[model samples]
Target: MFELTAALIVFLFPLAYSPGPGNMFFAANGARFGFAATLPASVGYHVATLLVTLAIGFGFETTLQRSPILFQVIKWAGSAYVLYLAWKLFRAHAIDKVGEARPAGMWGGAVLLLLNPKAYVIIALMFSQFLEVAASSGEVIAVGWISSVFTLNNLVAFTVWTLVGGQIAGLFRDEAQAHLLNRVFGSVLALVALWMMFG
Candidate 1:
């Protein structure tokens, strides 16, 4: 079991650790607002991730497979939301003036996950790959176990990115440099949104 879990960890490293939409979202928020302010969004995202990943593992993949259009709708809608956030990030208040903007709430995070096609694809693939491994081990690992690990990995990654973003922003004493940093994060998110939609 430990060996299989180690393998699963290895498989998830790049996926969870790499800067994706979720991680970038929190990082940008942390830069604009703060890490504490982004926690609700993180909670929303991970909770949704847990439910959706389990659903996919339990049989939702069959439904998604049968309806490609459903998945496409989710993709486009989520991408639009991401682009909207990127626009907001582009015009976000600098850290010195953080009171003017509000961080995204729990609902925003949950909706982002629920509508994100890329998340569904990754969850489905994770099940396929890890479940296949578990089958060879002659031991059954529940979907809950896999989902928890994925969620925890993501939380760790998001936390790191958020703190790092905040720390970098903290280093900039001048408002102009801080604003530029926010825009850079916004640009990164814009690119990530485009990748999610069209890449």
Candidate 2:
């Protein structure tokens, strides 16, 4: 149990803190819409992610791993969707201009889970590295324990980032600064998509 706990914490720390498309998008939304508005999206995103992790741990991962073409297809599709999100973020109204609420609903978040390569890698690695550490009898319990802990950690980390973005949203009352911020984050998303495709 101690070893499993330690392994789970180590994995959670890096996976939760690392900047990815989800984090970036959440931050951007928080900046555009206050944390209050971004809360649903954040919740939906992590919930969907947790569901995927659980599914993968249970055996869906084997199917994904065995089918190279299917993996590649999902990967490319997800990357393309991210790129589209970047464009949308870039085109959003200026910070000072009154804008509608962000559209990242529960389904949107679920769809993102499918496309997020970081999620794919983390799920694959978690099962490979951490599950191996457990005894055969400990496998099922370990997967559930580790996944629940990591999901909680992930939610907290991204919520904090979203709150920070909401706070910073006020700092960019200037249209120029807001535009620059959007461009920069959009560029980052584009880069991430390229990396997932080629890296």
Best by lDDT: 1
Find the 10 residues in a row with the least total lDDT in model 2: 94-103
Residue by residue across 109-175, what tens digits does model 2's lDDT show? 7777777766877887887877777646576787787678767877887887788778887888788
lDDT of each: 0.84, 0.78
**lDDT for model 2:** 0.78
TM-scores for the candidates: 0.93, 0.90
Q: How accurate locally is residue 106 in candidate 1, as Cα lDDT from 0 to 100?
A: 90
Q: Model 1, range 1-199, lDDT digits (tens) per residue?
A: 5776788889889988788898899888887778898889989988998889888988899999999999898999988999898988888756778475788899988987887788899999999988766665443356767778888887898899889878887876478887788789989999989999996
Candidate 2: clashing pairs of residues: none
Candidate 2, residue 68: Cα displacement in angstroms equals 0.5
Model 1 gets an lDDT of 0.84
Q: What ranges in model 1 sit over 4 Å off?
A: 135-141
lDDT of 2 at 58: 82
